[model samples]
Target: MLSRLSPRTWLLAAAVCAVLAAGTSLVYGGARVQPASWPQARPEPIALGRPPALPWPSHGQAAVAVAGQAGTLRVYGKQRPVPIASVTKVMTALVILRDHPPGGPSIRVDRQAAIESGNRDESTVAITEGQSFTERQLLELMLIPSGNNAARLLARWDAGSEEAFVGRMNTTAAKLGMKNTTYTGASGYEPTTVSTAVDQLKLARQAMKDPVLRDIVATARTTIPGVKGEIVNSNKLLALPGVVGLKTGTSTPAGGALLWAAHPTSGDRDRLILGVVLRQGEPGDALEDRKKAAFVASRRLIVAAQRSGWAKTR
Candidate 1:
């Protein structure tokens, strides 16, 4: 049969034989191959450092003020020039109260004041032009609601022009030992409004000493009639335990910052500790982080005071 096969058949048969041989070799080669082995070792465990003794404020720049009956201590960062947002009103309110005092004549909001007030921003106390409100109401509007209009109105009332009033702000800050602080506007909307965490601490401490300022800041809610409607206090931290009162600030550039004062219900207290954080995160988150940082620092200070016999137990 092999001799009877044609050349074509022979070629086909040879091809089939070759394919069969390749398949057999492949099968044997695959079976003969063995997996490689590796050396085994135990995984190392990671060691985390000790947690911070005190929780630090999460914001970029944070200032905390804790007041008691005793002395005060303030820790802050590089006294740099950064926008303060609505916190500029702190100085405005102080200057206004100093000039007008509490229960003084009412402030009339005019066109210029309203025009210079609010802008496209996250927070504002809308006050229309031609609105009339008491000096006390204006103070509340400035501090409680952080009304930009209120700040501008008070500034205009004080110095005749917002630019001149900012000059006054710088002058006042200098007098108060806030060497690093500077003001370009009453509402801190301008990026030129700058102060350090340390300088803000100084300002907060001074503001806290004023009975009227303290009372106004501690207030959780207030009503102030405006040209269009009534304004109300918006600082939610007033309701928090141990919170006295201070101020909250926010801006796109400055981030969310706060000057907070807190104290235990009873004690030979400590003076306020002021903390300021610049260029933090979102407004809400930054405020919360600053509060937490203030709480932690205050608690630590309280404990230290007790241990060092600085604060007497009730």
Candidate 2:
């Protein structure tokens, strides 16, 4: 029978046997034959690190996210978004700066801006109507004093109206991956304006990158061209060593909050841990008491991250 078969038949049978052998080897758990030159993959290196825990607020809610070379080390809280008050200005400032990269354009403070400052109970630099300020000066007044009016003027001038500016604020927040945040106005005066500490950290990191904003926030105090009485940053924490500028927020519903950026753990000036502490105490606390609560809570977070291996030594 083998001799009767043609050469083509023999070749076909040989091919079928080879295929069957390969299939059987595959099904029967035979070792796969790798190429002689096949390269082996090395295991990824693991850093010996532990997640950070808390000494967080016992009264009001607070959340923190610590970032190192490996990315966000960990986060704490209900992780729920809450009212963020004037910390809202950080978004206001970021949107304006992004739209106007050449920031020296002049802004004519309108009567409404002055009225908003004087009539409302929020922070302000009291920019007067018809008073012209260079963009940088405006930024100085707004960021340093935690000025609600300055934020309004900037939003209106940059986007042609306050509503439009706020629209831009929400849009910018969305782009920053702050899905849990919302901005209803230029200043975070309204209780409806809110965010989580985790969301705010994203905004904080992006905001710190702008040289103009970076310079403005890091300043403990400075005199603007037209403003009387030296413009001091409301963030007294700036006076603390390694403490730098970001912003602070307060309101009846929001309690006291702060967004902070600085090198607390590692002495490296270039590496900074961005921290967000929101609603640090009962809503009805006195203004100074609320502020203290926020400050103390944030400081504890920084200390926790630093000692718990989130911070690298300088």
Candidate 3:
């Protein structure tokens, strides 16, 4: 009966078989067939342009360090040891991360950090005593808001005493060759705690290497478990382009100081750029002006580094 079919019927039956015998394949008899071959094309590489010029500002001591095969720095008065203000928290954070990994045990906030926060009257996340937070969360509180209380908490947690933690800080600084650096407290609140711009830069470089600390400092704002609202970053430069983590400081002696870093991005193929601005603003300047001076100074150095093309070896 199959062999007796007419020519057109045979053709139609073959087409039906072709459609059904494919075992649910997409190819059909009436479907348009596309070309099996295609033209080959490769995307052209982008040409790197000349770096823009970076103007050196006159009001502050600053430096810019690039991270790469040949890390170089453009600096002004980086050798002078001065007060780093709250920038000490960077060291506090780095030391804590070095000893205790990010996901370590939760530490209950003691009244000491809260009492010290109120006594110092500096920036704080207002974490009450008996409130529990992970080491990572405590880091966010310390670095993001420049919380002195948080620094003290980490210090005590790590060394069992603030003095002992500070001792370790000095030991670490010495090991890192921060010759001009000194630590009197976990927070940079003590005028006695001092360091050169370059020394802080060294600390910043180390801090940026840690994923947990890097992520925490890069956050613009974060809410503490017990705190009511977001504790924003004290480093105002964080809002600027390419400006990322590290720390900031301001005090009667320290003036305004900032340790800032820039990460790699598609638009800027350059390596990491770290900038530090120390002793900015006039003695009697407004509070915001003092703060803005450090931020602006740090941003200027970053602009210069970017303009000069961080890829070029000095």
Most accurate candidate by TM-score: 2
Tell me which of candidates 2 and 3 scores higher on TM-score: 2
After superposition, which runs of candidate 1 have C-alpha atoms over 4 Å from their true positions? 1-53, 63-77, 114-119, 226-230, 269-273, 282-314
Each prediction's TM-score versus the true structure: 0.68, 0.80, 0.78
Mark the regions of model 3 whose C-alpha exceeds 4 Å error after superposition.
1-53, 264-270, 312-314
Report the lDDT tens digits of candidate 3 across residue range 1-314. 88799999999878766655554434448784433333336665554433445565575677666654343656676376788889899899889989988776799988887676566456666777788999888888888887788898999999999999999999999988899999999988898998887787777777788888888888998776677787888876677676677788888788888888875343455457877888888999865687788877777667666665654433
Lowest lDDT 10-residue stretch of candidate 3: 32-41
Q: How well does model 3 score by local distance difference test? A: 0.77
**Best-first order by TM-score:** 2, 3, 1
How well does candidate 3 match the true structure in TM-score terms?
0.78
Write the residue-wise lDDT of candidate 1 on 79-163 in tens digits: 5677877777888888777777777666678986666556655455667677778877777877887777677778888788888
Supply candidate 3's per-residue lDDT for 74. 64
